[model samples]
Target chain A: MAVQTIGHAPASSSHKGMSPLRRREAINGYVAILPWFLGFLIFTAGPMVYSAWLTFNSWELITPPRWVGLANFRFLLEDQLFRTALWNTFIYTVVSVPLQLLIALGVALLLNLNIRGTNLYRSLIFLPSQTPVVASAMLWFFIFSPTQGLANAGIGLFGIPPQRWLWDVNLVKPALIAIAVWAFGGAMIIFLAGLQDIPQSLYEAADLDGATPFSKLLNITVPLLTPTIFFNLVIGLIGAFQVFTPVYLMTGGGPGTSSMMMGLLIYRHGFEEFNMGYASLLAWVLFLIVITLTIIQFSLARRWVYYEGDRD
Target chain B: MDTHVSPEVKNLQGQRPLMQDHAADDTTARSRSLVVPRKRRAVVVHLILFAVAAVSLLPLLYMVSTSLKARGREFAYPIEWIPNPAVWRNYLTAVETVEAMTFFANTMIVTTLTLVGGILTASLAAYGFARTRFPGRDFLFMLMLSSLMLPYMVTLIPQFVLFRELGWINTLYPLIVPAFFGGAPFYIFLLRQFFRGLPTDLEDAAKLDGAGFFRIWWTVAMPLAGPALATVAILSILHHWNDFIAPLVYLHTRDNWTLALGIRLFRDQYQVLFNLTMAYAVMMTVPVFTVFFAFQKYFVRGITISGMGGR
Candidate 1:
């Protein structure tokens, strides 16, 4: 039957020629995807090339862009604010992403105990994530207000005096990190799904072997959930690096640039300062850092991430 | 007889009898020997979950509490969990203070159009990538997928320039037009995964009946894609509803402000009025929470599918 089917294919169509149906399908496929293709070129691909070109110039949005090769790049190397923004974003991503994932995974495991009220617990935990970042930023702003804020009141109960939260350079990043952690519910739900995908039999087998819960988690659950962990890690890292709205709204990258992030810095240069060229350069730098990190993560994933159906 | 094994687990058990036997034995033995410890564990788990849930909800609760507080009482030490007499009028004041009604109208217009256009364009492109076979299809799809890693910041300045050149600055066009052109790669990828999972027999039958690809996509495939479409719609609504950066950049006049921009402006202008600002924030959040609760299942399914690499 296989040999007959193979023989029929060449008999019906000349070599290196598509049959009529194949050609029609190809046409339909192109027509179907045309909007996305146009969008790619006009919005994504074209703008990317334009931005790269812009990085070489020093246009101020009004005057025609004049090419100045690598001047923006040279200035970028020496710009104190640029370095501060990059370092702040790096610190935020390095600290927050892992912490959020750990908390998310922990909550997901707790929710997966098959206890009653699971749905309610899940909704309650996930509610904060649904709140708009703008609104949440404002809410946190009030909560962190130095004298009248809930942060101080809550800590005062613990006998620790209220320190300046967003105003204090030492505390600003941690305050922002706390806000990011509050919305880990998105990752939590993903982790819950991953937990559910793990076959119960593995857990039952471990139980039958008298494995402790921690042992079962380390040996069975952790291995099975590695793919999910990797997914959250990559996503969280990218998101944390682009931290903007909170900083833009709450601190405006201040208390002396302590919370300055790449996203806000780009916004300031491009929109506020009208320095489109430098802003484009900063954005490209951000793009390169994110791409490099994602590549590294993917390469490292091979050693750790376990896909269930891998032949190896 | 263990109640904890979900139906999905039971389905897995039906496929493997050996594991099923072990599960059975393990459950019986564990239930007999560990009833007391299991009950204690349940209590402990519930306590932990309750604590976490409180932490999650506290800030929101505080927002509500502050929004209703009598004006000066916002900074009252030993934080008031509830207002003495709820300042329900604060909602009215929030609205009156900043053309809140106009902002609502603007936000609704932008969100609705973007939601409809995003779903339409994204689903069409998803159908092409998912259901059709063509040369360079995989290559194009991967190319599109790689764009997901390209930060929006990279495109922000140029797109701003492009829109400025088109004379679209200060208009809603900048925000609304992109959605009609598959602006969201993630949505297309998501809908593609959904389309791929759908059974193809119906599509094949439609083809045999002389229906064209578009007809099949609309009648056969789209009808079956209600869940995914709903997921995309909900996500799109939430995104455009909460979008700050676009409106902040594009809409210069207060007359054209969306709720996000309006609320931010309110915060800036009324820096001392925490109550009114909280009131405005609550108003902006209500719609999102309503949509979320109404379609909670789709949110879970969407996130789950995303985590699985759109399997």
Candidate 2:
């Protein structure tokens, strides 16, 4: 693609195959996209290579990187905070992703019902998803305020006493998870779109076979919706792992590192502490985990993520 | 700013025809029998949906009530669902405290610039992928898609370093400049899908009219891509407006903070002023909501249409 565009610039420009206008068009299109290409090379691709290079060193941003092959890796192996962050990220991802997908599927299924003003229900459910996370986090900060928050007030109705949401280290991740679940509208919207695309013929066929709703869901809908479900799940997992804003806003990664997400930790190192090299190492670790998990997902997806239209 | 009209769609006229046609066919075809049963069931189902809708609106309702309540009444025991002495100063105080106008100005600048840069970059790459038929185009596109799986956490540090090198660390440049370069691959892919779906005839006609690629894209393709472009614009604005981490990383001075960052400061600095905080929260949401409701039809239409094509 690069060659063809480059070739079209000079080689094909001389072929009389096109006018100056065509050549100009080719140049302009490439020019318009050049910023991103340059950015990818300088910012994205460059950092990726530098990150790998930094992974093997103990260099700070000020000093030249000292090649201490495998030392940073070994240091990370023994780093307790890295271990905690990794475990927290895993626990957060595993707990949140499936729960989110389940809730999203449930909401989408409910919205799928033929009903009056279903659009209103969709809009309402989708409202939280669109609300800026910073705003939502602020709202939740008050809502979960240990003393006089609404959540505790509401839960008191069910007789559960007040809990320190962001204050308690153990409850912090769960609190974040509960807050994260509120934004299931993204997954729900995707699932709703997916649900709409399911051919009615399948349901009719299942109904003719005397399949109950549960049976039909199990035999048809679940299997057919797997592709979308998989997509939402994978994306949700990646997003959940990198979740920083809410943690940053609601907890400041505190009451002491409880909400210190990988993203936050990296931010602290690279930006706050100016330890770009070490932060790059942490970033690389995060990249490896995401890639590995995503690969595993795609591999397992073949077994479960059914594309009903693709009848081989 | 109009609350009734959706931002992207001016008239329901576009979708109304199809819905009416479907409804008509549905009634006529099913009128022979079982229509009454289905309609009865659908009515019952709708009531249930209405209850769900009410449940969903509860939080917003709570926020409004809290915003109205006087300072002490906000946290009063046996919590008041309605404000006793409705305090209008909540809005005034919240707006006054955080330099809300400055924050809004900053937000608008960031959003507008990001939107412009994002659209230019995304559309350019999309056009390349859609029309060029170049070698490794598919491969490069796939590479972009793979990058989507690489969490933002990965490239963040490197990006910070690159920005620091360019002396963009404390400016809006880091946030705005990268946007001009296919920063978000998802949107680029979306634009690519939309571009591919558009018929080639228009561009060809433009070509025969002695127009170049840029001219064809701008005059021919863009005019026909109102809904898609609106979709891209709305998504870009929302992303830029709501972004927190990038600004938090790149911005050092308090004056440069975006609304999202400003809101966080409000919550932290005024921990006891629950009513004012809620007011701030509401103010932040109102504009986005207004934009949302204004272009709701187009917003939903764009989503459904974009999804159908993109995936």
Candidate 3:
């Protein structure tokens, strides 16, 4: 306000006319976002660069880093645990992402129906998502227990013998996918919003076409809802790749390292073994995988993800 | 500017997605919504939705029931849906033996500090991004949003080392302090979107009144963004209260543990007692439940906004 020269300039003036005011505002912009920039420098950028540096070297926490170019990545290719962890994460994601999207979309469809008590139902569905991962894992740890767990009890009524859930190498991933589905309301709400945005007139048009319910869903709802599904897919994949808290609390990477997801594997190498260099290498690998997946997803959106007015 | 779209999908949905796109359509299924559902069908829909909601809620209900069970009742032959005689002592025991109250208090501290810091920085930065005439604003905004995709794994080891160097490894500082520096990119983005949606007449009026950037933002924009700010606050509660990975990594001491870490430690300590583990979960969950019930509207809107940002 003290700088009278730049004050109250004519609106929509040329840049030459409002240079000082513009410059001041620019400085303010930078200052406003400066804290985040500093955070990026400290917490994200520097560490990320260091992490990249570590990938080329081997350093236990105490020792100086020793160059071991490609050794960590090479070892990861053949290392049994890394392979298992990678495979576990991939399988968990491949199975769970679709399951979660499907469940969420289905529930969102139900809630989107002009039914009564939608809020109550939505709240009940969302309740699990609000619980901390540790608590849910703890609760589900007991529920999925082989002998006395409620899941087993429920299945036993149909004479299916109680199965080892998280402890079982093969079933552990599915068990996790199930838990992911149980907390589907987060995405469900998103889908509800998406559903709201879809024109009800489309349904009326489908009705005029004599489309079947399943056909209408497949043709109309599913196609229109692809963007939201894609969003959830990308976010969900990133989240699933970093699955740790539940694994840490429930399985501890398992009965025999069966449930060893990549996150836990990284934690083990970095913190437990004090092998910072190797952990950084693995972390870089995870980072690349995530980045690549996101890029691929975005690129593939060229084929399936619809924007209402993007065509030329 | 990073928008994406399928060229054909845009053209395709214009006319129709039916007919030529498929021959495998399930022609047998009736399009129910074309007509109002009969009373019988409505009952079926209600029943089905009820069942789905019940399944969604089963784990939570079981957690509460198990928390109230007495000795030998937990993991009994038949899974009990209700405790025979609810033992309120389990709650007392959880508080007494574990000092669970300490964990809750610690959680409150972390959440409060992070919430305050996060909202302030995010909203301040959001005003700049939305309202100020910033050179390279778009590019910098992209830079910040890009961090959302950067895997925390890449930063975990180095960040731990950095925090250790700063002597913040075992304290709440690692978790709470970064938040002051606009740690939440999603919220920053959300608030920026929100701030942009506000009518700018007040800002212009304040500016003509010789109010500087800070005053215009503080006196005009902030007051108008109450709903958006509440949404940020709500989402942050959802995030910070249930945070596990941060607490797991940062806080090493039992006494310093947030509720998430404390209950985890508690569960392991009482591994044999399923009911006792659940009691800890119940204790941790109650406050979150209360907050959710209190602010249900904001929770829904905030989550929707997070998803909506991609478009």
Query: What is the number of backbone collisions in each predicted candidate, taken in the order shown?
Result: 0, 7, 0
Ten residues in a row with the worst lDDT in model 1 chain B? B9-18
Query: Which of 2 and 3 is ahead in TM-score?
Result: 3
Instruction: Pick the lDDT winner.
Output: 1
Q: What is the per-residue lDDT of model 2 for residues B1-311, given as tens digits with 9 covering 90 to 100?
A: 11232311212122221233444455545545566877887777677666656655666677777888886677787778877788888899888888778778888888998888888778878777677643344556676766667777788877776777788867888888778777477778777878888989879988898887777778887788777778888877877878888888888887787887777554444455678778888888888788889998666654443331111
Docking quality level of the chain pair in candidate 3: acceptable
Identify the leading candidate in terms of DockQ.
1
Tens-place lDDT per residue, model 3, A1-312, is 112213333445555665787878877878888888888898899999988888888888676789999898788778999988998889888887788888888888878876778778878887777676778988999889877798898899999998999878788878887887787777888898898888886676555444556776776788888988888989888888888888887888887877889999999999889888889989988999999999999999989987766522
List runs of model 1 lying over 4 Å from the truth.
A1-16, B1-31, B267-270, B306-311
Quote model 2's TM-score.
0.86
lDDT of each: 0.85, 0.73, 0.80
Tens-digit lDDT track for model 2 on A1-312?
Answer: 222344333432342565665555545656655665676787677889978887777667787768888877777789877877777778878998788778778878878874667787888877777777877877777778788678888889999998888898888889888777767777787888888888786675444333446766776678778988887877777777787888777787778767777877887777777766678889988888888888899999988888754653
DockQ of candidate 3 compared with the true complex: 0.40
Clashing pairs in 2: A1-B135, A36-B181, B5-B294, B6-B294, B6-B295, B7-B294, B7-B295
Model 2, DockQ value? 0.26
- Full ranking by DockQ: 1, 3, 2
